[model samples]
Target chain A: MRRRPGIGGLQKAAAARDQYRLLGENVAKLRTDMMKEQLATFRSQLEEFARKHKNDIRKNPAFRAQFHEMCAKIGVDPLASNKGFWAELLGIGDFYYELGVQIIEVCMLTRSHNGGLISLQELCNHLRQRRKKDREAVTEDDCLRAISKLKVLGSGFEVITIGKKKLVRSVPTELNKDHNQILELAQGQGFVTVEEVQRRLSWTSGRVTDALETLLEEGLAMIDNGHKDGKCRYWFPCVSSVYSSIGSDP
Target chain B: MASGSSIGVGVLFENAEVTTSGRPVLRRNEVECFLLSSVEFDSEDDPPRFTTLKSGNLILTTHRLIWIPSQSNGAVPSSISLAAVTHIYSHKKSIKSMFHSPRIRFQADPGAIVVTIVFRGKGDIDGFLTKFWECWRGRAWEEEEKSESETSRSGSGTVAQGLYGNDGTVRMVGLAGILRKEQEQWESTDKSLQDAFQDLNALMSKAKEMVSLAEKMRQKLLSAPSSQNGSTDDEEMGSKEEMQQWMLSVGIISPVTKESAGALYHQELSRQLADFVRIPLEQAGGMISLTDMYYHFNRARGTELISPDDLWQACTLWEKFDVPVMLRKFDSGVMVIQNKSHSDEEVMSRIRMLVTKTETLRAGVTASDAALTLKIAPAMAKEHLLTAETKGLLCRDMSPDGLRFYFNLFPEIDPTSQHIAKDFGTYGVWVKATSMLSV
Candidate 1:
């Protein structure tokens, strides 16, 4: 209120602020560098741990889960790519590649009967049966990762849900909403009657008939008219365990 | 099954019902009208002999008035059918009432006993009374009986007309009348279909009618094969069968909606979701992804779509309620709904069986392969495989082709003697399989 500060005073204050900002930035940069170095060291230690406990990691799921937890904390994704430090150290990438080829072969072999729409479980069963004498074990997780990699093929390989079951479609057949709806409804009994669908979905008979015809044409569904109820049962083979066993046997 | 002394006052009422979750069972087409918490049932007329029932939820459904004890320990829940209720006395307004909680009195039968509903917790007293009157006067029970008979008559009448229309002796209606009737039916059906596709709002309104029409057509188709057996060819039969299949898929009669359920939306939605997921869960081998569930549930609900946040909230509330299913989060942060009784051991053992095969030992199996083998979703299959890996049952193999899993041979392999194969364990078998491939 007495005498306002001059331009010289204002300039001096600005210089002090600038100096403080520079100093703060330098300190932050140094801290970041230190953290990066620490992270590098931790990553190498993790690699050593993996090498040391390779046997335990392979033989024990609980131990592997813990090891995975440790990897997560360090922001290390060992499964990100097949060709990295992990691939060289663990030889996992080559293993998945080999499995992918076998999966293609199996899919090709069963394409005729299933019309390229085979349940994942059935495929696994066939794979196991094909190599029953081998001592090495395979799990569904390994199969899934392999399939994800197969997406690059552009060959229309995909996993689709019909009800709760997953079906591996090797073809490029498109399924509309009507088809999906029918598949979902059939999940309860593995089959559905026209009356049941009509009552439940509240669709016109023509629409219901049209959807069912498409499904039948696609060979996704089978017809059963032998019941005493006199109602035709449209059975989705993808969701029916009994149908899988019966259809796959021959 | 606790002591009788802990039980509430016994009221003589007929046909009381309870659900598997210990909640009052609602009749088909019956909707809950009102709910009041901490309601006490007592008769001031018979004080000493009758013990006062306290701290229970009083629910008024379209068909009956039910009171369920808040705690299940030793309380005997009771219900009085609206049909049995003789009269409802007006709430008395006196100087003494100004200091007391809100109360309503009603006279029910079997015996002309006056039952007083004392609301110890806050609720809409007027709304409950109004609904009580409307339900009593409406006489919905009688309508149910009439509708049942009407359905049977219509069903048989249609069958008779459609199947025996060509019989020469039974020409009650002229051909012109039959043709005119058919044209009128077609026009009506066409109008409905056109209206349904006009706009979303129109479709929502016409959805119920569409469902009924679909049901009628299916009924006609069901009897078509039996009546026209001689004229039906293989191609015609095939087309007819296809038509039948389509009609079978359209269902989900009453979907739970927020507007309909109000404050209890999540709880009601959770219950309905539980019932809906049973078949799908079983088919999926006991577990399904939350994303998949969202799609199925919304599709079943039709127009009344729910947000993901609401679904998550409903799933979280399952922990508070005694439900047969549970929500699980994988290490990958992928959420899923699974049966409470679903066991991982069986799946683990199945994986164990799968990996030990000769080809899998040498080449490994991918997640899709495992999904196929386990009869589960690829995502769920991967979770199981990862769990197996963590348990040392399997080890992962990552390659350019894909990620695959093989039975753990690391434990049996002598890491120090890398080039040599131990002649006994899984490692040896794997080595043999690979060598044969090389040959």
Candidate 2:
């Protein structure tokens, strides 16, 4: 109602404020309801879409990854449950599950010589060989998803980044900052001498010695003193190309 | 990691549930106060009956003394309920007792049996006995039962059904349940809202309920399958995820408050955070930036929001506990929470495969390219690439296009015969890959 601009106006303002609060709350609630409705519809549509392109999604790794990305955005995890609608319809859960098992098999097989650290390419190569008879080709996307799921099994399986490459660590050994730095320095020649590490990393001799000794102890580093410079070369087999043949099947 | 339940049968002791990580699965509202590893639980009344449960980890909680085996054996993971304790004998100093492992003796019933706990591990025995005495005298179980009964009495009119609360309110389930509950809540909320505005004091008192109401509404939004309704449009999907994230960070039904946990606040909070992060961690691909974790954790806590310091303290406390998740600091000082068992070999292997591809081997891959290939964030992909480079899996090539990572061929270059390439080695493979690109 129209009112005078005085003490009565103050009362009117208070009433208006209360009304505004209520209106605001209602709007928020309605928005949430709308969002939920939209989500439900999207889920139904996704199921339909998956049904239409099951083969394309399964066979084409790029298409499968794009589909997975779409699922992630909508908060629909086709791999969340092995017995859910998506799993039954797409069998994507079992696909990832089987991939997870094979991943472990590969890690366990290569752990002996690589000292639990293997490159992604080597692991995928082994995996592809193992799954060669299978119809669908597995991609790095599938491996990442499968490995992410493996976190539930404890801290035994994980992916770590060093420099520009990703290393898959199968053991629970922690590579400290210093260890990582030393490893990075060795990337140039597949080996780093103690003096070379000191020159590049600018680390104190004690610190370098401690890190190198720990790496050697972990069996991650192989000592190669057969050099003309007389500098003890620490050859990291996990990082060095010389040992790429380690996990390769004869 | 212990993967499954190994609850064993015991004649004298109560078999308790252990988590996949081999820690005891605490009951509702129960908080662990202290832990002493490699402690043996033996009955003085019958030595042979309790001999099986030897050198296990003794955990003292508000309501029970859980003794989980240090290593899984035929012996069952067991506990002696503090509720059963009849009396605790005070520590005695003697020449003979000083030579042996520190032990605490307590008397308990069904048969008024004397239980002796031998502490063989390196732990503060005196401190453990103090907690044991405190837990026994606290009568926490009785207090819990009393409060539970009071809640039930208040909600006497409730008809018990699926997802029943102690107050007899039907906890909503599914879309229909949510819609029905929404109507009931709105009506009650409207009445309360009007009443709260009547006086300033009333508003202050009603603040907690207001917070809880917000929590309830957030949960409803969270429960609803809103993501399913979004079309194949990317912008809509983005907003849907954003909305879902907003909803997710709004409520934790029973946040571990400082008032509730008191001196054991951080410890309890640590355990709760450990349990809470499993879902979010899985969603984040087993690792989450600490800052993101902080927001998610605080949002889920609703009204009982914690400080950054409190979260930091809780995360740091994880190192002492056997929780499956651990806090890690990157070389750049960015902290992250990840699974304790997250092995780098798994990721490294994948990255290795990525760079060695025919085209990638020649042109090399940028962080964005790696991110696209790996299905991870570009920043995370960069971290992985850096780690791989550090490990000698790849070498960086700084070009106009930016930092591109190529498969390291230095090992295959034999310095004496640098011009020559071996057919069997990756050097030869790289030459073939690059040569094909040139042709």
Candidate 3:
């Protein structure tokens, strides 16, 4: 209408917009830097908290859970490595390394009984028995973390699931599908009958017997033909309930 | 108390249904039409025999008009079947009516009682009334009864008779006639399939029939083995069993929909979902990823697919109900559904057994290795392995060969005596295996 203030006015408006954008970016950058500084201070405070409550974290499961939660909120993984700030502050790495060694001792001692397979609960119980005088209490989580660190050794130490139970395996025998299936079937009552396996799995008698014999040869299963039913039961000691091993020493 | 006795207040509705979460239970096919919160049931009768029920949720369902108290203050939830609602009083618009909360009066039951529903909460009262009128006039309950009876009667009826039209010409009397009829059926089915694929609506309409057909085929397959005894081969039986399993997983007959459940959609969906997950959870070794469950559940639901947010809300609502399954979020932010009885201790013991095997001792296990051994998803297996590692049952090996787990022999190898193998331990066995590899 009135020449619309021409190109000069438009250039001035564009310059102002660019200045505003730059100002906004500068404010955002400042806020981010301030956040980073606050985060660093918060992390240092958390480290202090962890250092103070180290004993409680080691001894009490509930307290340990809370500590882990705090660490998680701050994106700090105490179990990320055996080196660095966490290990330097708490010697948690050495503690697990010691526990891992003790675990191997127990597993080796009881290898003949369970055939290189032991329940995690039983293993913890054994560790507790061995470390009775130790100030730090060992939980399942602690043992698992220690074991994870032991992976660097290249030993065939790992955990496997059979049915609902978790069993620590120290041997390197490959369990075929049939063997795993049989083990899983035996998990419910600690033993599976040849007939029961055949019926449940819809496998022929030959297949069931062959799988059971392989498990037996592998030392993963024991033959139990003591039942009056005259059916042979394949017992997986690793997955059997704790009651079955009540009288046995770890 | 006096009003309670005068109004025959002792269980007015005999079949008073409530879910584990104390939400009103809906009858099969009896969809909820409308819902109004903070409604009061008042006795407008002259004798004032019926006690006024205060601050309750009034629900209009196809089968019944239910009123449940918000708080359990000695007042029982009551309902008036739509069948009993003889007359609905027309809404009277006046200056006084506008000033007060909206109300709807209706004549109900054997006692000639006039009940007034007072909407005290912020709800679309007009909308509720419209649905109530529509449900009463629709008589959906009668249709449901008719269909249920028809299905039950057809259960024992001959399938062939139903498929063929009654032309009084004995068209399918023999094997040859049956073959010819089957060919004709194939042609018709092919045409219907083409029509179904032409549009989404046609596909949806055909989906129900497809589900029923699958169910029928499954029933036949299930009965086939028993009837034939030793006549069927192993391969035939195996394929038949597989087909039956697929048919069993075909669809959920009545999926909970927002329109059908109204305000109680998520609550009802949660309960239904809890029931639905029982089998799948069992099959997944007591745990399954939330994402996988979403797919399985939606596949079962067919056309009424739910959103991820809806599924999440439904899962979250499980805490309020007495459900066997629960939603678990791992430390890695992975979400899964697992049975309450699925103990981590059990899984840990199994893992311990797997790694200690002679073969596994020489060559460590990958996530896929654990998955195959555990009969579970690889991702789930990795979580289990990580959990096992945390428990010190297994240790991880990260090299060019990728991540693998070994039986934690670090503790067994005395760092002070790294070269010397323990005579009776896994370290000795490992030494022997490695030595053999060199040979």
Candidate 4:
């Protein structure tokens, strides 16, 4: 009310403006404090829900039997409310699942590609058959360890046996636990190699590599660029290495 | 890695090692004092061969003799092991011998190269002889052998105590039972040991260098008890306590004192420093503040303490060796020695979970709060929080109340639109958290 004084016009008017400004500052500080408290509450419930959902998907027997390993990236343990915990876990759940698939994908390159080849040599032939641009042969050790990780998750992917030959591919029956964002990021690129996915996402090497390794294991994606036509491709039944071939995790 | 050559009179044989800094590494517990150059050896029974060892430095220690080649070679020069000494000839003052620079001759077998040390550097030759004779008689090699056995003995005892006992037998008693028995043993042992160690005079004379040094200092301080006590107050007492603590840490049985290491002082000191850093490093979760290390290293050194500059030089030398530790200086000018394999990512993830939780988001986490979660000291926890802040994994809250940290929602929050959660980001979770707290 003290903007200016009329005894001399300026002083009374200035006094009125100062009081109005002081009142506005008090209201803004009060509002921020009140909002902060409310935000802290909602956060807890979301975190809890996300965490439990991730765990259920990880431990479910039907799913466990398909992947090598599954883990719910730690969400909230002590301080977060149960609801808040799940929300946080759910946020990153899809990425976690993708890492599992990539591990399986890398493993597939070692065995056989023709009806899942038997040995490293056959795997190399499969990559050679692709004659696709920039496709490389996969090694045995990488495939074995990645598969072994699945078992650590209390789950094992389908290592299909073709007759008596040692041919297996860990396929999660339900691969679409959560991975749309990844597919979105790919921009209809379908399943791709770790290097390609990482480049496209502009994510750190570790994060992309982890997700791609998960994608391959889910059988949602396979290394297919090697073919007689030499066109590097990731093929799926109706989707073409893109059967939404993404799973959050075991 | 070795060969048997004539090894000329001036040429050094095997059993030599040089530190990465191009300084000669010494045998365990060998402390150096006097240094000289152009030194050589000759014997009464051999041919008139003269060792043409040019420009190399000579060193005398209480334990063994040491020599180092120059940096011009781009590598450490070869040195001899004094443990191989077969005989030591007494220096004579005969007419012809007096004309030449003083040289000490000794016989070391395996090839009987009758080593001659030519002292050309400016140092007291008599002091060098005094120390050399003291070192030779000290039998440092034997002590080294004993220390190895002692280490093995302690290691095995702990393992045995886990499975059995020190009597070369497995007791297989439950830990509670063992603790009870040990408690009894300690009480009895403590009394007798205390009684035996009570003599002020005998304790002073017991060849305990650090203890005597501390005792002398303590007595001098006590003489003026109150009249001068105020002047020697808390800081004086702190230093006194530190002196006592150092004397206790020097329990290494035989420290590599300067009197024993000669020209190779800092280099040998560096290796010993490497071995010594392991315990403090472990206690500090594979890393420790350099200031902490400085205190620890000097305490371990006792009377032969080194300066901070030496500690830094030693830590910098770790990169050249296959040692499992390293020295790191944070951008904050806080220097630390960390295990090479220590992972900041693991620590960071743990802290992320800690501060982002509903309670921490509401109340925030002081260094002590992080200490509880990280299971470390508050000071160390603060360093971790600061590191996380720099990495954008966490952020700080400073006000009149206190400084604290909260998990960073930088990745989750849409900074351009703070209120919107983007349907599924960390910011969404954060918004929910504050709401839960308010309710």
Best by lDDT: 2
Please provide, for model 4 over B172-285, each residue's C-alpha lDDT reduced to its tens digit, 9 standing for 90 to 100: 585456445544543433343344234423222322222222233334333324333245456345434433333324423233434444554565556667777878778756
Please report the candidate that would top DockQ against the real structure: 2
Please say which candidate is ahead in lDDT: 2 or 3: 2
lDDT (Cα, 0-100) at B196 in candidate 3 = 42
Q: What does the lDDT read for residue A144 in candidate 2?
A: 79
How would the candidate models be sorted by lDDT, starting from the highest? 2, 3, 1, 4
- On TM-score, the stronger of 2 and 3 is 3
**DockQ pick, better of 1 and 2:** 2
Docking class of 1: incorrect
Deviation from native of the Cα of residue A82 in model 4, angstroms: 68
Q: How do the residues A1-250 of candidate 3 rate in per-residue lDDT, one tens digit apiece?
A: 4534889989988997898677656644443343334334434443444444444333322223333433433333222112345754664544555455556646655755555567889999987754444445677877787676555433346666655667675533331245666766765787888889878877755456655775676445678878898877777654453223322312
Runs of candidate 2 exceeding 4 Å displacement: A1-250, B1-9, B20-22, B33-40, B52-57, B69-76, B83-105, B117-276, B294-326, B340-343, B375-379, B398-402, B410-432
TM-score-better candidate, 1 vs 3: 1
lDDT of 1 by residue, B37-102 (tens): 778877776644235356877777667777777776556677778877889988788999778888
Residue B161 displacement in candidate 1 (angstroms): 8.7
Complex DockQ per candidate = 0.01, 0.02, 0.01, 0.01
